[model samples]
Target: MKVRELREHAKELDFTPQEQVRWLAPRQLARTAVKAVLAAVFAGYSDKREVQEVLDADLLEAPCGQPDAREIWIDYVADVGDGFDATSSVAWTLAEEELLVPRAIEGTDASPAVGDLRLRRGSLLVLGGDEVYPAASATAYEDRMKGPYRAALPKAADPPLMVALPGNHDWYDGLTAFLRMFTQQRPIGGWQTRQTRSYFCVRLPERWWLVGLDSQLGSYFDDPQLRYFEKHLSANLEPGDGVIVCSAEPTWLESVETNADAFNALHWFDRNMIRTRAVPGSKRRVPTHASVRLWLTGDHHHYARYAERLPGDPPGTGVPAPDSRRRQMVTSGMGGAYLAATHRLPAVLPLPPPGSRLREKDPPVAFARMGRTYPDAEESRRLARGIAVPWSGRWLPWRNLGFAKLAAGLHAGLFLLLCFLFALAEGVLRPVDAVRRAGLDDFWGFGAVCLGVAAALFVLGFLGRLLRRILRRLRRRRGAAPPSGPEVATARTALPPSGPAVATLSQALVALAALAITVAIPFPPSWDGWLVLLLCLALAAFLGAFVGSGVFALWVLSAKGGQVAEWQMSGQSIEDHKGFLRLRIAPGGDLTLYPLVLKTICRDWELRDEPSGGKRPVPTGKPAVRLIEDPVVISRGA
Candidate 1:
């Protein structure tokens, strides 16, 4: 979640036709109910069996150590994110004073008291979330929290089993940052946390097994959670024991289905009954379970307890609520976040509990401008809302000050800034509509991704050319054969190569095409006049095929280029060296070479002809093939 910090002022919510009718339906003792909940999570969280990490004496010494402080560092939270900005600023302001932050879970004098709830026989304390606000490293765990209330919870409380799943926010830039502070194995002075966010199955003292899914992948890989569920649930459920799935981004919110539309199709909670198949636990070899029992989540920063009856799910709703117990969904994310409420959509009734009517408010209602023939006004616009918004009846002032004002308008704001900058650019020079119809701007965001790929390829080409030249010069100095033929191979001792002669060739080709297109015809202003999309692809491919190939071939094997010997000829002294070139020996003893980087790349000039999968003619003795390197040297040089 990004940050949004404006002072919270009291304003009445807009009354929906139903709300107007239900206003006197009694505030349902909402204040009392909410307090009851806050108390439960705070006090009861400890009854679970989660063991806090005992850090090395040196790890925390440099930062928080005081002469009398204990060497073992435990509870403080660590946030690693880029410092303040619009997003970070919001996170900081909102974070400074509310919600959950691993604060002690004790009882309050007002209501159900903190120490009231109990776990289901045995349960793990699961943190399926982005526990801190804004995720900025500068915002320490304490910067935006109200924990003293929970700190009052006594030590007699039992802690739940600790099973944590990282969220998109937890992974500010990359996951290693948060992992370094909490979950991973860190040396005394390691920079980032070295932990794996793989799914974890926690075993309960009873027979329960709780699975924590790391949904952080939603930002990295498509369908990450779905894929993980598919892979493990088929084999992880147990019969006598119950199953609990905890994740950030509760599946239910997929409730108001956008795009393809299925109320909860994308939420795993919505799909659980379909995922669990009969399988034994990895360690306990028992016919544990074929179906799961519960789903708990946080991320939608309010309390949401949803109940649903999928067509075939068995009823597991505990007693009083027999019809809704089997499938329980809870969003305890009230842990910490600036709270927002959802707009009551016009035609919809409250989805009914355990599905509640609370969440961040809906987006704005845009107005379309009336044509010239009519009154000068705007109305009836089709608008899509954003993540957070003002309560239905409220309107926030859009100002430009750093603290409370928003410089832009409801929507035109972000883009007008760009248009203004462009006008300046053209005013200082000539009109240029590069972003019009025919230019690369016509493509969706894909342009940015493709450009990144092209940049990486170009850099590789540049470095390969540089290294190849260096090797060629070295061979000349050693009175050896110049390096040649797609990077350096074992044969490099007898061969050398010539790097690409034209460095600006691709750019030049693009420039000529753009020049021709600009002068040849008068196209529509809507048409962005440019062909860099296709042109860039062609050049990038050329680079990958030719220049890229040589660069790839040089790193697959641990061998030097030209007169330089990359690997120890035959000795163990080469332990620290990396293999730059790949050595492939086919069934017929033909060898192939490839270069190694993020992935393997084949050299165009050094293709090794190999036998296919079909049978190969061979003698049935001594493994039949003798593969050898050139000039096998002494053990010391291996």
Candidate 2:
């Protein structure tokens, strides 16, 4: 298609229902912060699981298929519902009847080679988590997620079943919209939703199972959910059965600073529920031979697998151990969200964590990274550089105009405030004289109000600290380790400052210096003070808009703080290097995973007439689809 034709076609297509989330936008930032705080505060009080239980909404059916129905195909995607380009690309790919294999499947010692594999659409579609971006709302879900997917495949004669796990974003609205959309027995495009709650279990063929857990913003699992799982899982699981567990976040990979609660919950579930077959009131709990064969998640927005290391095998090698019941922990969150960096993933992961309560009694177990990252670490590093100069090519201030304006406004406000402080410092007003000149009959009242505001702020800070202390004490009582998320390691603490702490300190120092330089130079109002003020304001705005992103880039480059990197990259709205998983269960209960990736998304779309005489988007360019790695095979042990 010609450029003009493409532009016209795009305009007429209405291809995108919602634009990608501008994470750095001031309003979006504030809204997200408020939502986060409110969600955390009221998650327990407004527990949706309790409501579901009260309503008897538990639709826990036997895992998806029959015991003998061993062979099946399942598609897994996570962290979806962001930009139209990326989300649509994934939806389009999943909607296709079949995909042509690009390369031969070279055999490995662990997995046999099945060359010339033709990838077909799965009967079951599993959305790992974060199905929508920014926050969860009915409109947001319809626009960002359902719209693109519906356009991709409006209908199917034998539609695939769809299920989803709720991520942090999905829980922003307490799963109100999520449950309504997914559990209403409605259809999203050609995919059908049958899950009655946020969490679900699918029984695949040959005693294999797929369990999607709703961690509820990485907080504690409710009693109802635990009971539901026990009723279905513990009662039915047999010896030597293989299970696949899916969660919204890759808690195994997250550091204590990022998701300690999630990590603890996952390990606890794995141990008590899966391993020991223990429940709240089990009389005699015996360690079950049934094992969790694979652990899957999607909050990280990338493809990374931490495969259990064989007894004597070297790390990063593709060799599989004989009779190995070792599990593979994979993160395939690249459904449609902004890409996360894989360069920072550690080579080795010690399960249950080194010093956690879970590890205190168990033997050490480790997982070595299996293959290179989907985009590769080097490619991720290169992509990360884009954050440094996010506005290099574009019209005017580019798509970051909102962020720029926010920065500029904040800078101007700060400059004005600093000027007032400077004036006060220079004795521009004696307190008594100022009060008299202002001619306020309610001066004392105004003072009281100001003092009250200050006191309120002080109380809030104190309460926050007190809450943390109480939580820590509660954890100790429960024989759990203290969470490290809000705790800062300093010289005063017994533990030394870690890499993230160092990076945070450096970032803070840089920010302070920038603030000092912006205000210090324009000090002491003189005859030419207005010019100085204008220059300072202009500089401050420029810094907020342009240089603020540079600081973010610095954090990304350092690759130390996961949260910091996430904040910076969320603004990138990346369109390429998107992917999903195509999993197949063979007749013999062997599971094969194909990590399919599209390096470049199809952008030039044409409005084409379909078989039914309706119009839909047909990409002028075919998506560049390729395999992230050779198919990963986990065999059903004897």
Candidate 3:
């Protein structure tokens, strides 16, 4: 099933008005709140069981042998498993069928379809991170991961090797389901690459090695996993080999000030594994001439690529040098999870410098653009035709102007309603004489208070802007002297651009307008007026709190959900296509990445070689075949 077909399938699902309301309304928010509370209570127990089981198990160490061919292809996708939604599950299943399945039969050079790159049947398939979602429970794995992939790939006598690494989600259950699915020797649909431990190294053709690390729940590598890498290095590494390091999260992209702990393990790994250097004063060094050419990660739920050049290299170094001191960091986490926004990412990011001063972060401009939605020919054409006006009106000044006006009106109306209720509450609680003196009868007193509130908030906003300006000016004065250290550079980059004063003024105006509406409604001196006022006030507060909580919960799910939805609602939305990286390794150890978008599998399939009549084979194994309920044995050390 292609993306369009899957979209149609999604529409065909039993999504009644109520079901649609569940996802589009606050019902899902209530569900999330309930889940959050349950998770808080039950989450920690899973970790203890997972740790004990891993420590007790006699772990199998199965590093794959190098492929015979001079050139090898590898396809990777991470952060997969669409959470508990039937529609999303079906959509992701189609994505897997399109992307994971080989274009042509084995041992054949099939004619390529437009925009289609054929992958070899026996090519290695790597699940970079986060195999299941909403916590890595056994049921989640079966419903989201195992069942979908089994249907997509099916069991073959000879199938592609599959290896996976654990993301934070996988570690939520203490790696129980992750261990069972990947580490066990059993094949799921006949595509099994044996893994004894969570972390493993695979030797690709052409002196290339793929090392996947387990940055467990705390973003720290466990002692055993570190030891495993140490042993692997001692046994297999040689001088001048090219290495591709795979981690669950991109520590470099994280804010160093807030997430210092997360960076430590990645930094240590980089210095020792890639740079071939010892920790400060440790005097331990690996005997490898290999350099880390690429670092791949996928926890971000979007695609981004950053190329880091050696600090002293001159500008405009365009040519590709075989021995170039360049390392590429790519994040292709858009497997099947809720898509994250990349539109707001800064163009330049700070990364740790190479060698002994690895702790210091330096800003480097990324080569390729970073974003969730890349502009394609089709999207450009649609945008060029221009956005459709709402309500069938023509010649609007701007495409989104109508939406902005609607939103502003809604906000203003809501505020007006709240103020009226508050006034009514006061009238009901206090004596009519007491409230009457406060100008409940005349509009002036009420208007004055409303204006006063707006004025105070506006001044606060203005003062904030003024303070930021002062700080920037002081920093600039200090910056006259050459930046002497990393701290200065970091401080300069961290400061955000000053916001416009007009926005603050507009906000204040909106608040005043809302409050002003209350003055227009006449307040009677009777008990009936007091009762009506009180009811309105109570109802307003109750409804506001209920709705606010739901919106907040959705925001919590994905920080940019509200923004993404706003764009979609306004008809200015980008296409909802998720992508992954396809790395082609040349014999000379040169790596070329194809940023492959997942929409249709047959988009690249050749028309001439289209298969004839037979129905696609479906494996007869039970959908929940690998359900394991073994008791976790706790040892003294564990």
TM-score of each: 0.33, 0.77, 0.61
TM-score: which candidate is best?
Answer: 2
lDDT of 2 by residue, 113-149 (tens): 4555688898889999999989999978876899779
Clashes of each: 68, 3, 3
231: Cα error in model 3, Å: 0.9
Pairs clashing within candidate 2: 63-202, 63-203, 64-203
Report the C-alpha displacement of residue 148, candidate 2, in angstroms.
1.0
Worst 10 residues of 1 by lDDT: 15-24
lDDT of 3 by residue, 1-638 (tens): 33333323322221110111122223333554555555455655544333532543332222234336677666677877753222233223332423333333222356423443443433567788888765677767765667546535555544556778888778766677888878766765546766667777777766677888876554456566666666565346566677778888877655332243445677677656655644435786654556677778888665666555444545542422222355667787766664444544434444442221344553333332222233232343333223233232211213233333334444545654535444564574433223333444454565566567767876787788789878888898876533234322232243222223333334444443434333344456565746744543443333333332223222222222233222222232222345556666766656665555543211211111113322221222211101011111111110
Q: In angstroms, how far off is 532's CA in candidate 2? A: 9.6
Better of 1 and 2 by TM-score: 2
Q: Scored by CA lDDT, what does every candidate get?
A: 0.29, 0.70, 0.49
Model 2 TM-score, 2 decimals: 0.77
If ranked by lDDT, best first, what sequence of candidates would result?
2, 3, 1
| Better by lDDT, candidate 3 or 1 | 3
